[model samples]
Target: MDTMRDRFAPVVSQVLDEDPRVAVVLAEIGAADFQETARRHPDRVVNVGIREQLLVGAGAGLALTGMRPVLHTFASFLVERPFEQVKLDLGHQGLGAVLVSAAASFDWPAGGFTHMAPGDVALLDTLDGWTVHVPGHPDEAETLLRHAIAAGDDRVYVRLSLQANRAGHPVDGKRPLTVREGRSGVVVAVGPMLDAVLAATEGLDVSVLYTTTVRPFDTAALRRATASAGTDVVLVEPYLAGTSTAVVNDALADLPHRVLGLGVGRGELRRYGTLEEHVAAHGLDAGSLRERISAFLARRDAVPAAS
Candidate 1:
């Protein structure tokens, strides 16, 4: 099984390789992984060193010169390290640049908390005219990338990961990834964990809300998803709870709804383990989620149904 990066990089590399005017800009950290793609299309790769501000600025400059640029970097650095450049050079100027972020959230276990980016979803949501995507799986990532490349939008920041994903998951390029009937008590998954959520909810009356476009979200579709949901709505995200907290808060502000935001809480994530073990350690395994959901249902049943 290939990592999400491997799955998407090749497909995109193939497309960009065919386009003569397309170029790629990489942070020093990302160059090693995508070197082959850059090598194959030598005229395309631009290495911008440790300076992310310059990296984004240069990408904007290159895009203004008629070359389509895909800027690659760590999610943490992409947001915190270069906020000014991204805001001024990319968002404000409305320049065309596809920002490809790798190892989003806790995808980089070795990098620790400082590098773990949990605030991107909320941060990017505030940027006007910028397209934000958080692909749940590789195929979805590929589809989102293809659209972003062709979109010619001023700014597009993709929240990506190197996590492994099972193949053959259906990805809706036009709308949110809906796995079941848009019904009551939906499970909104942000990453490859949607598969686990599906397995856990087998035989249960719950909908799976798969979100690839985080910012500028399709509110209409989301509203329709919960139109039947009388209160049992939950959002299962891979990032920290705060990521979904803001989204759900804002989403429910005007409506009478109960939204549960689930995610990795304050804890020390195991450093020495396979991705599966880490997932288990974080309560992201299928079995743990199933247990939690069962308990939640039990509690709901114990409660006197409103009125």
Candidate 2:
């Protein structure tokens, strides 16, 4: 709560105060802290109370009436539960709003499988022109939210996960930020997984690129980074495994290179346990990731370089 989730309310509050066009639609999940915000602007802030469909529909309605709606809820309820609402009300209408989703992936494991939305970004891909930002820290979340509000009419999705990096990478909103330098390969850490990726690559000869914006792929930046670093790419995503593999493939289409994809598995694990246990079960723990990546790099090393 001290990290990503807690950072949202204050940003939304500031935006609501600063812009009359901004409206917040809640659905019982994030209604508590924002109750006063809703009360202050009775007509602008609304809590639809567990009705995710109504929640999205309300945001759409607000958008149609010339207001920019900022929708907030758990990832599952925001994207999966009311997917139709998102597809129709938001996408079909060609409306623009800021979608901030909490409890991303396996945040609250106790809430169980039903509470997770590991495929949210993949689903967003089905729609056209949506920019997805998976901020890895509270500071980045606040910065991204502020940017989204300031940018006006961007179909933006800010993914807030319980797992976080120690510090914000400070997105440029254009390209992936290269935080580390190397020569053999490039490891692209998407959002919250940066810390894990950093720890995993402790002694490896690989560059690390941190990005919050996933959509639009930032192919140019990726190509530049990868090409400069021997073109070996490893995408470490926090969501469903291989979600961004195709993009990476397309980005490096012209080159002969090796790539490794890692993230949460597609098949259901069907076991309830602590966060660390869940992470380990998915092979996302730092130690497991290090071993997997080490093996991948070793395979590339085994190949004979061009004579």
Candidate number achieving the greatest TM-score relative to the actual structure: 2
- For candidate 2, the per-residue lDDT at 279 reads 84
RMSD of 1: 3.7
The superposed Cα distance between candidate 1 and the true structure at residue 224, in angstroms, equals 1.7
Q: Candidate 2: lDDT of 75? A: 94
lDDT of each: 0.71, 0.85
Q: Give a tens-digit lDDT track for model 1, residues 1-307.
A: 5556775567667877788777878779657766788778777777888888888888989877888888877888888788888888887777878888887767767777667776666666667877777777677788788877877545777778765347545554446767786444767776666778888888878877777776666666676777775445666777665455555656656776666666666576647455567677767778988887656655654532210
Q: At residue 41, what lDDT does model 1 achieve?
A: 76
User: What tens digits encode model 2's per-residue C-alpha lDDT throughout 148-245?
Assistant: 87767878899998798888776765678998889989899999899999999987889999898899789888887876787878888889888888
TM-score of every model? 0.84, 0.95
Which candidate leads in lDDT? 2
